[model samples]
Target: MDDERSAVFRFLRTEIFPGGEMPGKHDVLEYSEAGGFSVEEIELLRPHYIRTVDTWAENLRANRERAIAIQSDEVYDRYLRYLTGCAQLFRKGISNVGRFALVK
Candidate 1:
């Protein structure tokens, strides 16, 4: 990821999801195995997340006045930017989302 994209992800991680951890595929696999769970499927969900964020951004724009009223313009704008950045990252493959199915 480029510096700007990394910065955007970092900002989202820190400001929006404080103390949250983004684990890699290997990390997830290892943890699941250690917990005696077998991985049945691992689905890469970047495309889905891209669509999801796009929808969120569109909804935010549609409800801009209400969002700003509920929070502030700054908060609304920040979240909009965060959603936009997330979509971009997912589309460009700079970031990814995943779903894992495990059987214990």
Candidate 2:
């Protein structure tokens, strides 16, 4: 995992998803078990998310003028920064996304 104090992390925490935190797989498993659920499966989706973010960044760039016109230069730049940063983080494995199945 990347340092939480990293510029990208700080920007994301403060601007994009306030109060959001990513928990480790073990943390999720333990929490679920404590709540009387069994972990059925966990599927990592980091690669998919990287692709998704990359596509978003591309689309944002393509529609840069429209985005800025519809929103604001600040908003357009912020989202572009967020999407590109997320894609890089996912590519480097510093961030992860997942799908989980639980049985109660």
Candidate 3:
């Protein structure tokens, strides 16, 4: 999961920082226009995100022993609870973990 998240962040970095590791003034303008998405986009993507997390949670549940072997029982349990809770929050519209758009 962390690797997947890192990949996403790297993708964003490419969009927001083309030349170097940090954003320049021109990059900032680009970011304002195209770097970040909007709430409507987030809302549109929420269901898909929920479905993905649901699958991940279910898979984790099914492979509990392997997960425990990879990490500690406490870590495995916490991650499972987190994924489950995130799905519920997304379903209820209480939170959107992937909502990176700045509210304006």
Candidate 2 lDDT: 0.89
Deviation in Å, model 1, residue 3 alpha carbon:
1.4
Given candidate 2, what's the lDDT at residue 85?
87
Across residues 1-104, which tens digit of lDDT does each residue of candidate 1 receive? Answer: 58977798689788788899788899999999999999999899998899999999999999999999999999998899889988988888888989999999
- Report the C-alpha lDDT of model 2 over 1-104, residue by residue, as the tens digit: 44643888889878998999767788998899999999889999998999999999999999999999999999999999999989888888888988889999
Tell me each candidate's RMSD, in Å, in order: 1.3, 1.9, 10.8
Q: Which residue ranges in model 3 land beyond 4 Å of their true spot?
A: 1-43, 97-104
Instruction: Report how far residue 64 has shifted in candidate 3, in Å.
Output: 0.3
Model 1 misses residue 94 by how many Å?
Answer: 1.1
Residue 21, model 3: lDDT of 60
Model 3, 14-50: lDDT tens digits are 5434465634334544566684533333324678889
Candidate 1, RMSD to the unseen true structure:
1.3
Q: Is candidate 2 or candidate 3 better by lDDT?
A: 2
Candidate 3: C-alpha lDDT = 0.64
lDDT of each: 0.90, 0.89, 0.64
Weakest lDDT window of 10 consecutive positions for candidate 1: 1-10
Give lDDT: candidate 3, residue 67.
94
